[model samples]
Target: MSFYLDHAATTPLRPSVVDLLTQSLLTQGNASSVHSFGQKARQVVEQAREDIAAAVHADRNEVIFTSGGTESDNLAIQGLFSSRNPIGGVARPIIVSAATEHHAVLEPIEWLAAKKNAQVHWLKTGSDGRINLEELEELLSSKAEEVALISLMWVNNETGVVQDIPAVAELASRFNVPVHSDAVAALGHIKVDFATSGLAAMSITGHKLGGPVGQGALLVSRKTKLDPIFHGGGHERGMRPGTLDPAGSSALALAVKSAVAELDQSIQLWTDLNLRLVQGVITAVPEVKVVAVDLELGTARVPNIVNFIFPGCAGDSLLFLLDAKGVAVSNGSACTAGVTSASHVLLAMGYSQHDSSACVRISLGHTSTQQDIDAFLAHLPEAHERAKSAGFTV
Candidate 1:
């Protein structure tokens, strides 16, 4: 059987989500319509919205459905920036971010800087893959008025490192600067309570949590204001314009509920599997390092993802070799616009170019089994041998 270790890219759709999607597809009527059939469709949509809101401890109206994580991220950053507005002839067009963020959050902030004259403050991370909280506090403390918002990821998708989002938000709050987090990788893996998080906005996608690929949400707290990204309809608080997909919405809602409900068990299983996989690789290779996890910090990184670097082997080579042996993984974030270059996350955490390119990420999910882990370990030694013989790519 093929072992799929790329849950950070996307997890297999859960059976419950598939069932809801199929049932909703068989029904008819636009949720925007006012007729009986439309009202029924609207009910389904609202129910899904409520479910998602409850999962994040947000208000029903605060959860705005979008196409997926990328769109949700764009809406949060662009919306918050546009809404922040300049005061008394000065522009508050500065976006504060970290180098370790996913492309979804980074791209929008970069776009604003390049085209719209927005200034970006890039935060640095330590070797542990954790950003310096004091750095963030200093930036916000110096000129809180000039800052639009601080966007950071709740977790590093490629490295599986969890950021202390609440701590970040608390610091930002002192300056009255809103914080938006890309929680795509953190949603199902951690206890994410947006209400308690003190965050102005948060983004999450369904596929990462065992729902369909297209559905996602941006949780904007009622206290925060956001300008519309798409301007045709008043739907989703005018933040996003499009006809609602009841099927996708209900499916995603069910997926979030199920994931949150089983989070404790899921974490335990993944923690076990990660330790097993890491130990097996290190025992066999003796020269590889699983970058983020530490004996002191324990599972500070998410339980599913384990990133390791082979000293003399290219990451892409190891990836290909493992794939040939029926194990699937990634050299870095799958959302890197198809580039196989070294991970920016590792580089930000202080790895040199050559060392950064030597990494592979193995992420687990609900469908992963001990047998699947065993099969991967069985193939890893041979794959590492082949990759090492091939040597590093220039």
Candidate 2:
């Protein structure tokens, strides 16, 4: 049987989500229409909104629907930045974020800087992949007024490193600066309470937590103002405009609710699987070095993802070798997978270019089992040796 270990990229939909989606797809009516069928459709959407809000400790109005994580992130970054810097207003054009953030966050920030005259202050993280809060405080202390927003990721998708978003928010509060987080990788993997997170806006996607791929949300606090990127109908609090997807929304809501409810059990299972996978890899390939191994599981890092570097071996070689052996894995972000470059996350975490390019990431999810891990381990030694023989190329 083939092993699937790339959950960080995307996980399979839950059975409940699939059932709800199938049912909703068979129904008809537009949520914006005024007829009885419309009202029924509206009810489905509203209930889904409420369910999603409750799942993340947010108000129903706070949940703004989007296509997926990329859209949510783009909206949060560009929308918040625009609102923070209005025409004829004081220039708060500086954005503070980390370099290790997914392209979803990084690209928008880069666009703002290059096209809109915005400045950026990238936060540095240590070798463990955790952002340095002191550096952030220093940046805020000097340029708080000029800073539009501090956009950070709640978790590193590649390495499973958790960032202290609450602490970052608390520090930004003193300066009255808004903070936005890309919580795409954090929501189901950790206890993410948006109310307690102190963030002005946070991005989450349905697919990451076993929901439909095209559905996601940006939880925006009432205190936060956002300029719409899509300007059409005044839907989603006039922040995001489009026709709503009742089936996708219902499935996403169910997925979020289920993921949150079962988080504790999921963590326990992943912790065991993580240890098993890491230990097995080390035993089979003694030269393998586990990424962020010094960090405590379920606290500093999520237990679902385990990144390892096989010295003298190219990550692409190992990835292909594993795939040929019926094991699927990833070298880095699936968004940038086909592009042959070292992982930006690893480079930001103090890894050299060689080490960054020489790493593989194996992420687990609800479908993961001990047998899956065993199959991966059983195939890994040959893959490792073959990859090493090929040597590092990228």
Candidate 3:
């Protein structure tokens, strides 16, 4: 039997989302149009927005639909930067973020720093993968006037380490700096209440929450100001300009609703599964290192994801071996065109390049079961042995 443990990459879509998407697709009209047909579509889109907002404890008007997490991230970063540092206005050049952020957030910030001359303070994390808040306060205290925005992820994509976004937002509030969080990983897995989060903006995607892959949104606070990244008709408050997809939006809303409704049950199941998986790995391979194991699960870290480093084994080799055994898993790092590299997140957390390259990520979701976990554990010992023989390779 094929066992899929890489749910953090993208969870399987729920049947409800599929049914809603299919039904909505059959109905026609652009959400931006004013005709009767368009009005119907608009109603669907707005209702979806309301459902999603209610799920996240956000205002209905605060949700701005986007293509996905990457686009949402780019919009939040670039839009906020442009608005804060206007053409002929006072310069707020500093961008506060962490080195362990997903490429979606890191790339845009780096682009701004490289092309727009924005200064970036890459916050350091301990070996536990949690950002040093005291260090952030020191930076904000010194350069609060010059900082445009602070972008940090609510949960790390690789290690599932949860950050205190509210604390970060509260800190930024004192200095009047807008804070944006890439909450794509954290949205459905944890209790995410946007109203209580104190964030100026947050990004979330559908695929990670068992919705359509192309659908995602950026929840912008009413008080936050952001210049448009794409110029066109005033869609999504002029921040994201394009005809909105009612079908995708509805599917996303259903996914969000369903995930939230079952959050408690899912968390408990994942917590148990995570414990079993980690324990199995440790028992089978004594050299296995579980990342963020010391953190308090469901608070300091998420329970759905567990990253493991098999000393003397290349992550890619282990990944291939597991796949060969009909167990699907993912590396903790990015894979580009068949080339595997060390995870930046692990590197930022003080892991050596070798250890970073040797880690694999096994993430769970709603569809995951104890049988799937057992299958993975049953096959991992052999995979580990073979991978350890293969050694580390770029």
- Among these predictions, the greatest TM-score belongs to 3
The C-alpha stretches of model 1 lying farther than 4 A from their native spots are 86-90, 295-299, 333-339
Order the numbered candidates by TM-score, best leading.
3, 2, 1
Output the lDDT of residue 56, model 2. Answer: 98
TM-score for candidate 3: 0.99
lDDT string for model 2 (1-394, tens) is: 6899989889999998999899999658989999998888989999999999999999999999999899999999999999998998549989999988999999999999999989999988899998888888888888898999999999999999999999999999999999999999998899999999999999999998999898999999999999999989989999998888888899999999999999999999999999899989989988888999999999999999989998888898988999998889999833354667888999998988898989999998889999889989999888888888988777
> Per-residue lDDT tens digits of candidate 1, residues 1-394?
6989988899999998888899998658899999998988999999999999999888999999998999999999999998897445327978999988888888899998887778999988899888889888788778788999999998888888889999999999989999999999998898899999999999999999899998999999999999878888789987888888889899999999999999999999998888788888889989888887672222467888888988888899988998988889888833346567878888889998877989999888889888878988898889989989999874
Query: Model 1 Cα displacement at 199 (Å)?
Result: 0.4
Model 3: C-alpha RMSD to truth? 0.9
Q: Rate the local accuracy (lDDT) of all candidates.
A: 0.88, 0.91, 0.92
Clashes of each: 0, 0, 0
Model 2 clashing residue pairs (backbone):
none
Query: In angstroms, how far off is 232's CA in candidate 1?
Result: 0.7
Question: Which pairs of residues clash in candidate 1, taking residues 3 or more apart in a chain or in different chains?
Answer: none
TM-score for predicted model 2 compared with the true structure: 0.98
Which candidate gets the maximum lDDT versus the true structure?
3
Q: Candidate 2, 306: how far from true, in Å? A: 0.9
Ranking by lDDT: 3, 2, 1
User: Each candidate's TM vs. the true structure?
Assistant: 0.97, 0.98, 0.99
